[model samples]
Target: MMLAIDFVVVAVIFVAAVGAMSCKNLVSSVLLGGLASLVASYLFLRMGAPDVAMTEAAIGAALTTVIFLVATRRTQEVEE
Candidate 1:
């Protein structure tokens, strides 16, 4: 059961990473990156690293995402 859960989380992280890379829109990429970070945090928690998980969630997921979104809003989107 735990192994299955780990596999699922790993899969999600890979998907989110791919999605972020393929995204042309900055906002979408930022959101996907945050999703990946959150998933990584969850995995960290499951692996018995609560400190690392909290750091990842607070800095990687939340703070970084907000920063990216703000930066995205300040810039103009270019159409391809």
Candidate 2:
């Protein structure tokens, strides 16, 4: 059961990473990146690293996502 859960989490993380990379829009990429970080935090918690998980959630997911969104908003998109 635990192994299955681990596999699922890892799969989710991988998918999220790919989604982030493949996203054409900056906002979508940032959101996907945040999701990936959130999943990684969950994985850390499951691996018995509560401190690292908390940091990843707070900094990796929340703070970094917000920063990217703000930066994205400040920049203009280029048209092809």
TM-score of each: 0.91, 0.92
- Candidate 2, residue 67: the lDDT equals 89
Tens digit of per-residue lDDT, candidate 2, span 1-80 = 98999999999999999999999987899998999999999999999999999999999998999988877776755321
Q: How many residue pairs clash in each candidate?
A: 0, 0
Among all candidates shown, the one with the greatest lDDT: 1
| lDDT: worst 10-residue window of model 1 | 71-80
Please give, for residues 1-80, the per-residue lDDT of candidate 1 as tens digits.
Answer: 99999999999999999999999987899999999999999999999999999999999999999988877766654421
lDDT of each: 0.94, 0.91
Worst 10 residues of 2 by lDDT: 71-80
Q: Report the Cα lDDT for residue 6, model 1.
A: 99
Error of 2 at 65 (Å): 0.3
Q: What is the C-alpha RMSD of each candidate to the true structure, in Å?
A: 2.6, 2.3
